[model samples]
Target: RGLKFVIRKVTGRCELQRICHNNKPGARRTLKIGRPTYCLRIILCQSALSAHPDRVEKTIDDIMTLKKVNPDTNPQLGISLQASLFQIVGYRSLVAEVEKLRREPYDCENPDHEEMLMKLWKTLRPDSPLTGRISKQWCEIGFQGNDPKTDFRGMGLLGLHNLLYFAEHDKATALQVLHDSLQPKHSKMSKAEWEQKNFDKAIGYSFAIVGINITDLAYSLLVSGALKTHLYNVAPEMPSLSHFQQTFCYLMQEFHRFWIEEDPCDIMEFNRVRSKFHRRVLRQLKNPDMALCPHFAASDLHLVNL
Candidate 1:
């Protein structure tokens, strides 16, 4: 039987090691006979040569063509093809780092965690649109409180969302806690509506904190977590900049509801926040003169005098 191998870097060590074989599908195995051409890594290495999707298929065809013309000379050519098909690659190095962090006894409150987090953030400086390193890091380590957010602020909305997804996957409780922290007090509105509102608000403030940057990834992560998991249900796809802004506004509304119920600080002071683009804040209140009851809206009903 042809042998297969999976090379993984040991956690935190930056050195490659082989995982054991247990007859698991695609498990790494050592061969006593000839060298098997197949090797896999948890993450794919960044390929320097750009292969077009069509060209990759064509290249395989060309290789097969060559093998056919000289079968006697190409015993290993087939092996190479088998290896290429089974191989996997990318940021497994970061995954190892995250796993190492988890096993270590370092205190999160210790100053070293912050240093490690910042270093990890730096390691994820991707020039490409999708950041696989960052994604794998979170998947491996899960959430380490708000430090990931604080350390990763410059990464913008998409970065936050990616982290949030990882947090949710590994630390659902923590993500909920953060959402609760940001949520506004008291609400007579629907929870789904409130979740939407809170997300909208969070997005809005995050923009001031993040500016014009890639945010859809972040927004998608949050929406999937908060809404999909029934923390609150709202739209999943925040496709455009305008949708993100709208979601931000909606999130703010929800946050305000939480804030009212929690009564953490003066409501007036929260509104005084510098708006994204410094736009004036609009207040929604119910008029007693209208058919709605006074308690229905949290804001003052001047209709008591009317």
Candidate 2:
């Protein structure tokens, strides 16, 4: 009986000490009443300002999250903020920033979110020259050996290859880069080692980028109306250009049905007789092998993304 009573007294003493240690509720109340509240308000104001600033309706919060990747901050948190930026602003703006950064130098210490900036910029201004600039930026970033996720500024070997799909008519530099990246490199390393270390990732990004860029270029051409007028208004005296007209006609027919209300498809289909050229394009480009035209592979991304 004596031992049990002593045990109960000790247990009761420990429980009381634990309660004292848990002064959390009182401490929290004190914070709510004083300077802690003011500090919290300041933090909230900063966070809100970071979220929406200067009425550009084009906030950098998404890219700023990339800054959170600093050791003092959080990577996952940064990614989440990026995800929001991507959803709200689109990848084109990020692409745009990368392109612009290529035209200028970005501090290595700041290593800005040039990719996201480029992507977002392109999103807002589809016709901006910044699109091609991004591809060049990728090359610059790659030459500097930055991480793929953080510093992919769009002018790397892959960036060059991707940019060419859209740049077939305008970007000579992109074409040259594409040619250089694909040339076989003779190294002491085995093929497997080369692929593991470099080739596979480069090749994959190259293929995807090529396809995406092409689609964007094609969409711009077809949707912009000038390409269609150039094709349809060909001088009848020039029989040699008929084949080109036929190719444009065919592409119009194939995609026009899909985009009935869009300027690209609608303008081309306005005259049914003008549509005869459309049939010829399908015959020229489509094959049983399901092989994509160099143009098709690149331009299709515009369809899915836009």
What are the per-residue Cα lDDT tens digits for candidate 2 across 1-306? Answer: 476447537764222122223322221211221122244334333433332333112323422332222423433333333323222222123233334433443332443444544543343234535435324434321222223233333333223323322334323333333433333344454677654545432322232233333333333433342232222222111112222223232243244333333333222333442244334433432321121122343222111101
Tens-place lDDT per residue, model 1, 1-306, is 112211222231101112112211121221100122222111112221222334334443544453233434544443433333222111122223323332344334657544544443443322223254234333222232333444344443334333333232323333343444345444554578665544433312232122112233224333332211111111111122222333333343444344444443332344444232122112121211121111222222223212
Best candidate (score: TM-score): 1
**lDDT by candidate, in order shown:** 0.30, 0.31
Clash number for model 1?
32
Q: What residue runs in model 2 are displaced by over 4 Å at the alpha carbon? A: 1-190, 195-197, 200-205, 233-306
For each candidate, what TM-score against the reference? 0.21, 0.18
**Span of 10 residues, lowest total lDDT, candidate 2:** 297-306
Positional deviation of 234 in candidate 1, in angstroms?
30
